[model samples]
Target: MAETSEARASASAPGGDAGGEDDKHDERMLECNICLDTARDAVVSMCGHLFCWPCLHQWLETRPSRQVCPVCKAAISRDKVIPLYGRGNTKQEDPRNKVPPRPAGQRTEPENTSGFPGFGFGEGFHMSFGIGAFPFGVFTSTFNFGDPRPSAAPRGTAQYDEEQFLSKIFLWVAILFVLWLIFA
Candidate 1:
């Protein structure tokens, strides 16, 4: 279970998905709206949203006076929320497997801001409420962003040379394929 959580965290990290931007949509669909991580104990809101049960429950609990869907502000409640069960579970599984994991507690942000302005981390106004998720994810991947990736190797390095060579080889293969199509 710890291994699965660790894998999910790393997959959600900057430069994690090796397949590039195409995988973004796939990943985004399964992520919890509040936690902004892969959905564990996943549930779908009636308004058509994906969220982790704990995150959704915490959000709903925090705003009891206004029990609406976190993603779409539609009507929602503890009873209204449906739990998702994975087909991976087998009838012959271990005893520990029968019990569900405990819910994750919500983190309340401090009043004082540090990294970016206008983003009220204090008011539970996360950047991933839908719009800012792309830019935030992209900027944070590199360019002085929080989770900075390591710098590329210098020009004379063998690693750099190998990468360039591989790119050229792929380019030639692509060109040959295109030419074959044109001539055929």
Candidate 2:
């Protein structure tokens, strides 16, 4: 009966106390020992001493097979580091909540299109539109029949004039036409 009355009195108090909240906030701000920079990605050792991920990674890089924590001085042999990503830092989505469908313009490649089993495009007549090289070491010739000149010759090969070739073909065609007219 006495405990119930005390709880009711505390609940009825206005605005609660301010000093208690401030001390909790101050305890959350952790500082790294190495480099003395504010930790973005945190890693905590078994001794409960915290250090920034980058700072600890660099320290481990040059050391021998056995690695030790700078704060607790404990031996760390296996490649295991405890992450300090608290629940307050991460926003988790509930599994029961349904995500809305994205607009057409916002749609990207399918997430299931990874390199797992039954993942890639199958071998068939229908091929995906992509940039590919010709098989059997093939090279394409850039020849324009309308211009009456073959643009296949490389720039460094020889002197290439489109007008000269077109005129030559025209002269031969004219002679053939005259011959055909006379024979008819």
Candidate 3:
């Protein structure tokens, strides 16, 4: 079945269907036989077979003195190995292969900052009063003059330790004062 179709197609064509010729033409185009990695500068052996340079070097290094070429099996001398830069017409296997590291001047600048404006670490104020939530915005009577509201406190109850709070406030104030003296 296949031969009949090939014969009919060949008879219909002028120069015996040029597909095979195209395949040979394409073969001469660069191709990597080792990793099948195609690229410009693909290494070519003295026997006229091609493979990527790094791939060929790695292969030879591992099995030195192995005269048989991997692709053609033609006898190859160890020194006949040649480097290829960018010859032949095969596309690189991985188009996005790693590029050489750029110099400092060519490197992209790092980002300076991230996130929303007018915000700093540990400095945020949010008040939400919706259904299924606490129904209150901050209302402090102690900070301003107001009638003393009735409060719940059992007898002999003690408030939070004042010493620790005072100490922390004093420490921060002292640090800030020192900084202000220097900067002002």
Q: Whose lDDT is greatest here?
A: 1
Model 2: lowest-lDDT 10 consecutive positions: 135-144
- Number of clashes in every candidate structure? 0, 0, 8
- Runs of candidate 2 with Cα error greater than 4 angstroms are 1-29, 87-184
**TM-score of every model?**
0.38, 0.32, 0.30
When 1 and 3 are scored with lDDT, the better candidate is 1
Question: Which candidate number maximizes TM-score?
Answer: 1
- Per-residue CA lDDT of model 1 for 49-133, tens digit only, reads 8777777767777887789997778999765766666687454333223335436668988788557564332322222122346
* Candidate 2: tens digits of C-alpha lDDT, residues 8-95: 5566456766664454345445767786555657777777767776677667655845588877778852245576666777644321
Q: Cα deviation in Å at residue 88, candidate 2?
A: 5.5
Q: Which structure is stronger by TM-score: 1 or 3?
A: 1
Q: Write candidate 3's Cα lDDT for 15-128 as tens digits.
A: 766886565447546557776435444556788887765666566666665757888888764457665434343564432133232233347788977466543322222212
Which lDDT values do the candidates have, in the order given?
Answer: 0.61, 0.51, 0.51
Instruction: Give residue 26's lDDT in candidate 1 (0 to 100).
Output: 75
Instruction: Show where candidate 3 strays beyond 4 Å.
Output: 1-28, 85-184
**lDDT of residue 77 for candidate 3:** 47
lDDT of 3: 0.51
Residue 178 lDDT in candidate 1: 58
Q: Cα miss at 49, model 1 (Å)? A: 1.0
Q: What is residue 183's positional error in candidate 2, in angstroms?
A: 99
